[model samples]
Target: MAGEYGLKRYFDADAARLLGGRIRAVQPGFDVEGYAAEVDSRIPGKELKDRVLVLAEGLRTRLPADYADAVPVLLAILGDELAEGEGMFTNSWFLMPVARFVEEYGLDHPDLSLDAIEEITKRHTGEYAIRPYVEQHYAPTMERVAHWARSPSHHVRRLASEGIRSHLPWARTLTMFVEDPRPVLEILEPLRSDGSEYVRRSVANNLNDISKDAPGLALATALRWMEESPTPETGRIVTHGLRTLVKKGDQQALALLGATGGEHVRVPRLSLTPGSVAVGDTLLIGFDIENTDGRAHRVAVDYVVHHVRKNGRSTPKVFKLATLELGPGERRSLEKSHAIREVRTRRYYAGEHTVDIQVNGLVRATGRFDLRT
Candidate 1:
């Protein structure tokens, strides 16, 4: 293949050794001549596709029923071999087969405990690309995480985050954590102030994941730790974990940062134009603020939209607007736009809907609206 694509010289020693050995042992029938011819014919500007295709073809022919069992050794060695210079692994096309193998193998292994699962997942996470297996096996995977939390290996500790990250690199979204993050939090709480920066970073990311689903929960938990007189290091860890959400209008989140809602910031006039907007309509939210404090300050805006479910439970969805930088006695005008859309899991009714703009994590402005069909 390299010869055909004019990439014969580009075949590094590692690639040539592995691909050559596999060819000689597994497929004496393999067409080295055909591969060379194809490589010679390969054009420039198609390096990525051509290289990936060659790897995929090799994987498809060699993958076996017991592939999952062999994956750890292969990945431990080969994954580092395949990783890019920046330390990030690429999702080669052969990833799905590995996922399928684990899925199939795991189904019959009901007795597999957390520790065993971690051994496989840690090895294959970025190499065999076993994210689907990780997501599908979250319960056991998390149990493994709890066990690993006590391990002495930083490598294993890092896996705790790499495995369950909502946005794990080049992997599927782990939405289960988005709704209920308790299990993941359990694994992270003990490691929040880990002596290793590597482990601490993972704990911070796990907290960040929780912020997406329940910002208040994340903030409250941080507050609970703070109230317990967290060590300075733990305080820093919690603060870093909440950095994004606090900047994004988690009121309780900012409170952890020492922002006083009512003392330094005040809203004299706050309004929303066309207080009512239906699906496919735009809601223009405006906030007018006054900084009464003697010094300059940055006040963030938070919006809580009252969403009434079909079951009559009203839930508040909060969003953060721009950061308003105000000078002493200065007034500001800020506008935000939101497009209303139908809720997939819930329905909205035509009624007096409520919207409020909060300043410094405090509700300083509010208005009412109607959602018509």
Candidate 2:
């Protein structure tokens, strides 16, 4: 990146040295400096994985002619570099680059690539790398991944779910899983009670990704996991997995967790303070709810702010409030502050923005605020 730096630096001079040394250690005569120069020239303008592939293209030329011979040689070098305690961003951070390397260099040879990818995942992770194999060899690759769900290595178990994420951030989308995610749930079955939190979090994220395209599959998977396991660990997966669906006010998702729909609840008041605010200011939003029926009710209350974009159109983004039970005749006032700060993901435009108070997935009250430039 020209302006600032982040993950792009993961492949730098040090990584070049480490990779060059490993290549030479295994293959007697290799072009280390020429490989280093290509890496240097390619990295100047590219981001993390973009630069990784740029260098991987150069790296492929220097390896042995045999695909099967080259794959294990690289895997052996990676094993040599592994330390006892390697964090995601540590010295062993080389796995991410190595994964991309395999994705590019070893596509023609699935079996060899699969073997190397499994070894890469056990220590760091081959989730991003495994996608190509899954895309190229769908059924067989997934069969191997399913078995990894039961692997003694938590990292391998994590890869079983993470590698197949429908919408994995910073990685290519797995279209097979996106079109039909039933197979993904099959992979998650063995890891529902995974002893490691690392593996469980991966499963939750994979399920969450499934919710974007296949909400039904995501919900069904969560329900089935809960029914089969019925444990606190499995319950956590449901809460995290259905979060996006809950944000969209999916009635089935709300009902799954016990929240009353808007029609069933009574909203007597809704208001936003300081009708007009500056670009980077604070706006206080408040609303009041009352339970009308004789029995208590569980509710998932949220506020949807329809932010105006530069084109004069607006999109709705839901923010969660409180989830609680209201007894009969009991009224509660809930206030959540809105920070009108600038965010990289969302650019704020000067215009009239509307905020709606919602119960379950229903809009009970709407309020407007003018954002001043």
Candidate 3:
């Protein structure tokens, strides 16, 4: 039988052998067998991030004890920069541990480590690895990151935005940026209309993270970006960046996205088909919305699934449904199916669940369903 699917499988013995072999090629004195064995022994039963750390630790043991001395070897083994807008994870996943090694061991050597991270990110990703430097060596790192924002390589440019995200996934939160995002905003300025969509998307995500903490600031920034550029690309970045605020129905956010006149829409009927479902079943939700206003209006329709938690309390998750314009007296019917399936991120509890039809951030109608264990 095939083994269960997991991220850890990606960093198993074979990956260690590959990484060890690369290190051996660069530093002929490197002990490939011992390094591979150490990673193989420590990796079993560890989670994905932990497994990467294990590989990093193996490198620590085999590489030269001095961080400065080790820098040249790591750089020599980086191979080549990924093609523009490619290889965040697909191209060189093995380099994750190499980046991690720089993160864990290269802190005291900010310039060297930053240089290494810049090169590593070109091939794989230094997003996770660069966080500590931002934390420990704030001024210098941000200065370097600002310079990277203008790099010729899209990968390096993306690192400028992605590396400084306040809540980058799989990485520690940058609380300093969360509290005061001015620095991050400055770094993102040049990247607003970057040539690469890959880089632009990171800028949007970074703005999204900023929105979570400082909605007003995020809104203001989005508005300014729109006013300054007003290009389709800038519009996409602003819309995605303000998604959380838009979901919460922030008036300015909705207005910026042209999802206005929510109050003039009426949901005459909302139905959840077969109101009860067990895990792994699909539930169809249908609703009819009519424009009550005499003038045409843009509508941003969304749904909220208030999932029952293990404690019996519920938390709301907003899902995007549709965005359309309705003329005077126009009516539209929309349907969406939601599958209640097992996933790593969430657990479903058997109980009553609530669904709300949200238009332009305002809840127009609500319904309920029972979930069976």
Candidate 4:
């Protein structure tokens, strides 16, 4: 069973050793000491996934129904190394054991209450995975989160903002709140002007999530927040959050930020070497850009490969071409080769496949030709 697990394969040795020290300090047992010694003796940067797996297995079987004993032991272990005074853990690794513990034993202790839930929330923003269990096990406890929003701890306040963000980047989707973010918005309204940048960034990211599915709602919220005298901190948060909308040229977003399109920087001419590609063949695509604009312009150049399906459903996938910093009247030439792979479902239409060069999110040039089977 341990051989099949990839957790240890992915765990970095350095991270494990660091985590092991903390583990040895908190989790008292013969195995923990043995594992810690093994990890400490290993070359730095070795991963501890296997050892953690062993620890997890031990807990799953040994942990009793009354988490009272296990809870304090874990808290003291976490508290000694990670959690000092204000509810901050020592490191992200500290969350691994706790998360594993929660995943394995959460339902067993259905009586878990508000205080325990709050303590776990302080573990990490990525802890959102445990929200369903929290809501199921401790409904009344989660409700009290609104009250804790006013707590002086930045950690608690951040949890209020971040814990509910609908689209936390790189995290799993929170579809429920993304649809109607009202409950969380109440928590954000007060924390928007939070004294800590930590809390403010979370608030901004939360607003950013609201922007994706509901652009109109996001713009309205931004406008509403703008009307009030915004602090510099709040302004930064709002601006960063609205970056996507601003790039997509949302009118309200542009007007509120008082930003408009600048002079169109002259673009370069593009050329493809083969000009045509065969399935399983490599196509070399190249481009030359001459910027005649007097001022320097930053441009993002990319290509969209339009693939025609067997059933004639067309889908385009964007791939990066280049990011250029062109100076006044500069000429730059770039080239890249793309391989054509014959996928099982893809049918070559025996006609021209279109591709276009995109400049800073705008399509500027077009090229097309046939792909032979």
- Give the best candidate by TM-score: 3
Worst 10 residues of 3 by lDDT: 1-10
Global lDDT of each model?
0.59, 0.81, 0.89, 0.61
Better structure of 1 and 3 per lDDT: 3
Better of 3 and 4 by TM-score: 3
Evaluated with lDDT, which candidate comes out highest? Answer: 3
Clash pairs, candidate 3, are none
The residue-by-residue lDDT of candidate 4 on 119-217, one tens digit each, is 655564324434554345445434666766787766677777776677764345766776677776777888888887777888888888888878787
lDDT order, best first, reads 3, 2, 4, 1
- The whole-model C-alpha lDDT of candidate 4 against the native structure comes to 0.61
TM-score of each: 0.52, 0.86, 0.96, 0.61
Give per-residue lDDT, candidate 4, residue 72.
Answer: 54
| Model 3 lDDT, residue 133, Cα | 91
Candidate 2: the clashing residue pairs are none
Supply candidate 2's per-residue lDDT for 342.
78
**Model 2 TM:** 0.86
| Residue 370 local lDDT, model 1 | 79
lDDT per residue for candidate 1 within 291-322, as digits (tens), equals 88888776666788888666666778777665
lDDT of 2 by residue, 193-310 (tens): 8888888888888889989999987888788777888888888888888889988889898888777645667788888888999978999998889887777888888899899989
Alpha-carbon runs more than 4 Å astray in model 4: 1-30, 33-58, 80-90, 107-114, 120-126, 134-142, 169-172, 247-249, 262-373
